[model samples]
Target: MKFELLKTSNAYAARAGLIQTDHGPVETPVFMPVGTRGTVKALTNEELISASASIILGNTYHLYLRPGMDVIREGGGLHKFMNWHRPILTDSGGYQVFSLAHMRKIEGDVTTFRSHIDGSLHTLSPEKSMEIQRMLGSDIVMVFDECTPYPCDYATAKESLTRTHRWERLSREAFDATDPLWGHTQALFAIVQGSVYEDLRMESAAYLTNLDFDGYAIGGLAVGEPKAIMYELTGKVCQQLPAEKPRYLMGVGKPEDIIHSIARGVDMMDCVLPTRNARNGTLYTRRGKINIKRAEFSKDFSPLDPECPCPACQNHSKAYLHHLYKTGEITGLRLNSLHNITFFLQLVREARQSIQEGRFSKFYENFCQTYPMEEDHSAKNAASRERRRKS
Candidate 1:
């Protein structure tokens, strides 16, 4: 894999580039939808292609636990197993393990954890992570590193950073010792973990860049940190990364967050929000996100978004979608996911165009004004349910 810088905006730190993967060339400032369990939830490969997704992600931990490596290898790798010919990125199972804190025991270089599936015990090390990713045959593979939670103290963050660096080094060595199983090129990208410390971030960045992995991903952010701090840390880390290599922000899904990260020179990203939230009735549009399950849409016969090119907006009405969702029809979820993913891809495409045409600052300003900044549907849903319960 290789990244070719195409252009950079004069106003912001934003840039546009192309990543040459063996599967295909992924335009930079790309949003990779999460297909964590080997599928992108409700949507199929054909639907994902229709929505213009160039790449999707898979989780190492989930795949290893469920289908196991034998199934994937027998199917000739994850691409064939999932029938997704596009570029696939696999995370090193680090974050999943981190989230399983209660069920895991971290010691030295390995973490032993019980499977959320069946409580079966398993261990993961940096070497093992690389081996799993290699077997999965992902176009891009992230290195194994601890993702420290939010509210982490200086001492804890510092210790985690040290462990992460050592693990990353081990990951690189292990990756270098093997070849991709499916006759395709695989790029190993290192994760920079420093929690929220600027000095530790810089230190981690410098250390990883020296090992010279294929690219760099800004990890350990968006883990309950304030939006301002996440943006600040992202900018600082981008400044430390090499200009020629691609810079990815891991697990950042919100539209506003994407805009800010792109302005901060982030090139690639992955998130489960588009699909996961769609399952819960959130449809992201040019105006903003709207909950399809609300009573207001019960008789509303207009399209979800008049200008959206997605199947949900083009071929169906809001009333129909709302009805389907309320009636427990499965198609509703897939359509919503399709629309949200399309909106995200279109947003990134627009940003890339703005950067290439030298109007990124104006684009950013307009996005800030037109797009809804804060919409906590979760809180709204909670309150609405409470009111219904009282009546």
Candidate 2:
């Protein structure tokens, strides 16, 4: 795999590039839909391709739990097992293990935890994560590093940073020691973790950049931190990373955050918001997000977004969607998901074009003004945090 820098915005740090993979070339400033457990919920591979997704993410922990590595390996790796036929980026699953498991215990270089699925004991070291991703034959593999939680004190953050850097070193060594299962280059990206602390963040970046991994990911943010702090730390760390390599911001959220990260020079991102919210009766539009189940939409027959080229918007109406969602029809989940994914993909595509045209700043401003940023998911985030807390 190789990433070629194509263009940059003169007014901001945004850049347009192309990631050349054996499967296909993924244009930079791209959003990879999350396909945890080896499938993007409610969408088929055809729907994914139709929505213009060049790549999707697979969670290492989830795949390791169900179907097992042996199954994927026997099926000739994830591409064939899932029939994605496109680039796949597998996360190390450190975040999942840390956040979703029970009986978590970090023993030196290895973390032992119970499977959130069946309460079976499992151990994941940096080396083991590399093995899982390698067996899956992912085009891009992330280093196994702990995704620290927000509101962590300096002492805890510092300790977690040290452990993360150590784990990254081990991860690099393991990745270098193995061969890609698919006979194609599998780039390994090191993640930066320091919670919300700026100094530790820069220090982590300074250390990881020297290790010279193929790429870098800004991890451990968007885990209930303030939006402003997330952007600030993202900019700070991006400044320390090698500009030529791809910079991925993990688990990042809303459309506003994506636009802001692009301006801060982030080239890749993945989030569950588009798909998850779609299943929950929420739809993204040019103006803002709207709940299809709202009473006001009961009689409204307009397109979800008249300008959207997605099939849902082109063929379905608000009233119809509302009816499906209200009746708990499965078709509503798939259509809404397809439309939301299309919107996100189109958003980044336009952002890339704007950057190439040297008008990203203008595009960002206009988008910020036009889209509503009134997401009050704090309670939801808190619930997620509580779910992941150690028992």
Candidate 3:
């Protein structure tokens, strides 16, 4: 993979770049929709393409546990198996094993845990993670590392960081030993884990950058930390990463969080917020997020978002969407998800344009004023975060 910086905002750390992947070029400041179990929940590949998604995320743990590697390997890797020819990024399954599985034990370099789906025992190591990702034929593979939970002490964080560094080394070696299964180039990106400690964050970034991985992902954030702390740590880490390489912020955030992270120089991010919330009848607009299930929308005839180019907004009214959701029609989920993803992609595209035009600061200011920064959504988001943790 190659990252070419095209432009940088003079007012913020925000930058616009292009990542050359084997599948295609992914524009920086990208939002990857979460496609955890091979599919992105309610949307298909054509729908994803129509929503302008250049890349999507898949979970290593989920795929490995369900269909297993043999099924994907026989299907000729994830791209062919899922019919998604665009760039795909897969996590190392480390987080899922630690967060979702029961009775997990870390012995030296290997982690043993019981499957969340069944009681079957499983083991994962850095080497094994690289091997699985290679078999899956992901365009970008993340190294296996322990994700520190919120409220962890310094000592625990330090120990996890040490193990993570060692695991990262093993991951790099394993990646070097393996080749892509589908005859396309693949890139390995390292994750920097330091919890919320500034010193540890810097140390981790420095150590990983010295290894010269294709990209760097700021992990162990947005796990429940305050928004301010996450942004502070992100800015600190991004400052240390190589300017030429892409900087990804993993498992981060709502629309506001995305805007903040972009200003902190994060090049890539993935989240289930837009999709998951869509299923629950929450819709994002330029003004703010609205719960379409609300009774007030029953008589409202306005479009979801008049300015939105998505079909949901172009063709459907708020009352109709409310009715579909209330009636539990499956089409409601699909249309809502499609609109949310479209809105997110458009937001990122607009941010890129603002950066190139040298008006990101103004754009940010105007967005904050218009969005109103709703607080009631926290309860809904918390439910999603909890599900993510358990997944």
Candidate 4:
């Protein structure tokens, strides 16, 4: 895998680039729709492709748990198993284990956890995470690193950061020991984790960048921290990372946050926000987000967004979507998923264009003025924090 820097905005930290993978080339400043358990919920591979998705994400923990490695191995890795002929990135399941605090106990170098499925006990170490991802055969594999929680005290944050650095170093060695299960090159990216502490975040970034992984990811953010802090730390880390490789910010997606993160120099991001909120009856538009379940749209025969080119808007009316979601029709979920994913893809595409044209500053200002978010936006992210795995 290789990333070519094509352009960078003079007015902002934003950049437009290309990531050449064995499966395909992924345009940078891209948003990957989360396809946990090998499928993006409420949408098929073809539908996702139609939504302008160049790549998608896979959850190592959930897939490792449900179908088991035997199933995926027998099915010929994730691409053949899911029939997605595009580049795929798989997290090392560290974040999933972090989220399983209730069922997991962290020993020095490993975590012993009970499965959320059947309460079956399993052991996961950095080496073991590399093994799991090897079998999954993703195009890009994220290194295992502990994700520190928000509101963490100084002592705990420092301790977690120390442990995370060790884990990532170990992950690097383990990754080197393995070969790609399929014939494709699997690039390993190191994750920088230090909670909300700036000095620690800087330390973590410096440490991981030294490891010289194929790429770098900013983790442990958007987990209830103020949006301001998230963007600030993201910029700080981006400054420390090498400009030659890709930089990915994990589990951050709101439309506004996407552009903000791009302006911070994040090359890629993956989040479940689009599909999850779509399933919950929310639709994103250039104007703003709207809940279709509201009764006022019952007889309002109009597209979800007149400007959207998604099938949901191109063909169906808001009243029909309102009815479908209100009456629990599955089609509602599919169409909503399609439209929301399309909006996100279109957003990044336009952002890339703006960066290349050196108009990203103007583009961002216009976007902020047009997409007026009035609701408590953090509510969705807060709720999503519980279910966070990879995206």
- Give the number of the best model, judged by lDDT: 1
lDDT of 3 at 331: 95
lDDT of 4 by residue, 301-350 (tens): 98889888999999999999999999999999999999999999999999
TM-score of 2: 0.96
Better of 1 and 2 by lDDT: 1
| 1-391: candidate 1 lDDT, tens digit per residue | 9899999999899999999999998998999999999999988899889888999999999999989998988989999998999999999999999999989999999999999999999999999999999999999999999999876789999999999999999999999999888899999999998988999999999999998889999998877777888899999999999999999999997999999999999999889999889999998888989999999999999999988899999999999999999998999988988999998998999999999999999999999999998743544554565676569
Regions more than 4 Å wrong, model 3? 376-391
Off by over 4 Å in 4: 374-391
Full candidate order by TM-score, most accurate first: 2, 4, 3, 1
lDDT of 3 at 310: 90
Error of 4 at 220 (Å): 0.3
The regions of model 1 sitting more than 4 angstroms off are 375-391
